[model samples]
Target: MQGKALPGFRDFYPEELALRNHIFAVWRSVARRYGFEEYDGPPLEPLEIYTQKSGEEIVEQLYAFEDKGGRKVALRPEMTPTLARMVGERAQALKKPIRWFAIPQLFRYERQQRGRLREHFQLNMDVIGEAGPAADAEVMAAALDIMRAFGLGPAEVRLRISDRRVVVAKLRHSHHVAADELVPVLAALDKWERAPADSERLLTDALRADRARVRPVLEFMSGLRDGAAELRESAAAEPLNECVQRLGAMGLGPFVEVDFTIVRGLAYYTGIVFELFDQGRSLRAICGGGRYDDLIKAIAGVDLPCVGFGMGDVVLGELLKDRAKQPEAPAQLDAFLVAVSGEDVEPVLKLAHELRDQGVAVEYGLRHAAIRKQLELAAARGAPRAVIVGPDERAASEVVVRDLNAGTEEKVPVARLLNGFFR
Candidate 1:
């Protein structure tokens, strides 16, 4: 019986794998340069750990079940909760200001669409145990640096910066909304830009009892722009203003803007928040993060200030394609050994293995194909040079080296071939 694969999931062919590896290599290089230690967690974790931090709303969006032992578990939807649990487990002994990063295959049960899937990879970067606004700026700068590394300029993407503290402060000071009611209110306000006018009004009314209290909330909502001047005048705009100036002083202001409408949907975010958006607004957030100063203590029972962000491989890949930057060139192998006839196969395989042992990526022609066909295959497989082991070469203990690009060939003794080809 033939079976079809599920939607929103994909199998990576060799070509696709090469592209994925190339993208990941760039990510790793930039992450290391910024001093983030690589980290990872189990693909599955206790269901309660996610539910505890993400709330019941996440249950509908997660692939969760009970094992045979009746222990509840779920595929990890995100890595922050796992990071918190891991750090909490060793909170007492671990040093402060832990800088960590991970690229994990995350799964979600939500419906799939452009730039999203039931399963995808995400790069998570976090800085733990630093609470100051500078810490927030540093995280933002790191994210911006990654985008710039991918060739995204200020015109291509902008970091929409906001502050949950400013949102909370506005709700409490301007609207007199109780602390208990703030989360839902902010969740509603987060969609104010996209929601219908009536729907936004209904949400605003639910948060504020008096029309006077609601005025500032509406004004703050209206003041959402790409400038700092208007943001400073709004009641719910202080934290965002502070963030703007900090990023500006660091010369990162050009890449960022104040957008009070960018209330991140995550519940744990407690301070500065931002989301990177394509200039066209043609897709969802390319990356996003915020301060979660209470997260470490909430999970590990130890107080620590932390900020970080996650960039999914899917959306960024789309953006890269849109920008015409997806790499078309495959990685090259050092050499492909072409065996001209059946009798030449063993020697060809032996030479390939020897080259591999010396740290060269080498492939041997498995089938006894024609010399022309073998060379074509080598070129197609992105081998820069081809080593021809014909009957004459085998008898003379020599190999013919051909540069595919330069279209040049030379004969060298077997003893000197390795160094000759490599050097």
Candidate 2:
């Protein structure tokens, strides 16, 4: 039978793995610098956990099934729900404002495209037990720090910030939309940038379809963007005024701007939503998060106001590639030992190991090949120095070192070779 692989799945070869590791290392370093302790959970969890928090709508987007024991299970599509569950499991013992970060492999059953994969890695950062604007600021700062660490400046990305509370309150106060219909309209707003005309049509249709129910919500969004002058003319401007003040106090007012349009796709968010986007808005969100103050209490029966953000590795990688700043090929080894004759192999191997033990990345020529071939291989591997141990050199208890880049050669006593390299 002919064999074929899945369309959206991919395999990582050695070179690709090296690059991925490099990117992950940078993420780890940045997370550590911000004092975020790393934590992890199982890749598989009960399906009901996600359904409970994200709603069954998420089930259509997840890879879920019933196990042999008939227990519904799912591969995690994101980490926040799992984090919430874990914190709930130990709510009484944990400290406040728990700072944690994790890089987990998340799976989603979605159409694969550039920067969107069925399987990908995401860096999640969360601050629990605090609901103040400062907690929100810190999370936003960390997200910005990550982008800067990747050499991205404000011009490369912008954090579009909004308050879900403001969204709801404005909708109810100005447009009088019912609570039940809020979520679907918000989901549509989240897609506005990608499908502007369609989103407008959907919003308009939703409002006309249920004017009494949806008009207030539409009016609220309109007021948020353009009706602000008119709102100043009205008396119910406290919420919008407070939102602006809080954003300023958080010191994120410049990096952030009110995007009445930013409705994060997830249903769990309760307040203060924001998303990071490329300057050109040509790609998906690089990161996004909002307040889920009631999630911990609802899930674990312990109340904690938590805010966090998830930065997916895939989109960031694409951004780096587009900027022509992807990590370069890793440095080659310092030395390569070439045994000119089969008899010299043992000594070459011994010397190679000794150099490695002395903190040098060294490799020994293993194939049975001529001296010229071995030297060619060393050059191709980008070895800065080549160590040639021939029968004559062995008899004299000496070795020859050739500086590949400089084309310089010297003979040194075998025992002094280590000292010479170290020097």
Best candidate (score: lDDT): 1
lDDT of 2: 0.78
Global lDDT of each model?
Answer: 0.81, 0.78
How far out, in Å, is residue 58 in model 1? 2.7
Off by over 4 Å in 2: 1-5, 208-255, 420-423
lDDT tens readout by residue for model 2, 346-397: 8888888888888888877668689899889889998888989999999999
What shift in Å separates residue 421 of candidate 2 from its native position after superposition? 2.5
Flag clash pairs in model 1.
none
Q: How do the predictions measure up, each by TM-score?
A: 0.89, 0.87
Summed backbone clashes in each candidate are 0, 1
